[model samples]
Target: MARVVWHVPVTTSGTGSTTALRLFRLRDGRRCAVGFSSPEALVALLGPDQAHTELGEPALRALTAPLGIDALVVDPRLVAPSVTVPAATQPAAPLAPAPICPAPAVRLQRR
Candidate 1:
């Protein structure tokens, strides 16, 4: 069996090919893809602490940003000293209420 692994960069497109998330099986002489949106759920499906890493910053951000509003997983182009936050996702646990991201994730959905 042949397998390829990927970590979503922005979760929009991926390296070379394999742009979207999917499962594929060789049919006839062709390998075709099937789309699946639940990487986190898939991760769960794969079992605990399987040891994986995400690829492509743009693809990853696109996949995660929308769904993971309150909880963001950033894959920056470069290391950041700090970043800005929106208001919705912020925890009121602080004395000074920090802002959370208001813009909803554009792509991808969370399970």
Candidate 2:
């Protein structure tokens, strides 16, 4: 069976969070396995990794009809880069605390 894969860029609703959707399509199958680059985002929505779905032919057609999806998934246009985390995703360094001054010692008088 022939299969097609696509990486579609998407943004979450009202959150401005951006990620890519990984779609796997099989010519003879009815269901598709939907995946995302950020698993955290998926957990936030579905609370699990169950991302598969079955959309009918019309729905699938409508999904790709506008984007000219065929062109984007073709060879030569898609390139897989080495897996590496971008600087923006890295954790920021913890801030250092300000130094405190010592209190002066007082002399005690005899009672």
Candidate 3:
């Protein structure tokens, strides 16, 4: 089975949301982000209902350096990859053999 890992956490510390989309790490080892069209957007996305802790790139972009956020940027391949499934657990299978023909007896006609 393929192993899955989260990108850790990034803390915004409540800054830098004035511009640029917040970048952060996701649980699936992928970068996450939340782009706000306006100041209202940011406020709506991250409400002041309570001190919020979000994961992924959105949190990373909102985040400044380090804190409670455990966001960790990881390799792309770790998250997604182009792969081919094996036919069976073991390889080395025998192939079918070619066919053989019988000899025909030719009666010589003496002229």
Can you tell me which runs of candidate 2 are displaced by over 4 Å? Answer: 1-21, 24-48, 71-111
| Model 1 C-alpha lDDT per residue in residues 33-73, reported as the tens digit of each score | 22223356435444444334444434544654554322222
- Computed on alpha carbons, the lDDT of every model, listed in order, comes to 0.40, 0.44, 0.44
Q: What ranges in model 3 sit over 4 Å off?
A: 1-22, 48-111
Q: Estimated TM-score per prediction?
A: 0.19, 0.23, 0.22
Model 1 poorest ten-residue lDDT run? 69-78
Candidate 2 lDDT tens digits, 18-109: 43334444455333434333445445544564343333344445665565543122211223466986668668899999889898898999
On residues 1-111, what C-alpha lDDT tens digit does candidate 3 reach at each position? 643322332234467353332355576655544333333434454553423333444445346344444444333223435698867877778987867877888899999
TM-score-based ranking, best first?
2, 3, 1
Highest TM-score against the true fold, candidate = 2
* Per-candidate RMSD, Å: 21.2, 15.1, 20.5
lDDT at position 19, candidate 1: 43
In order of listing, the candidates' clash counts read 18, 0, 20
User: For model 3, what is the error of residue 74's alpha carbon versus the real structure, in angstroms, after optimal superposition?
Assistant: 21
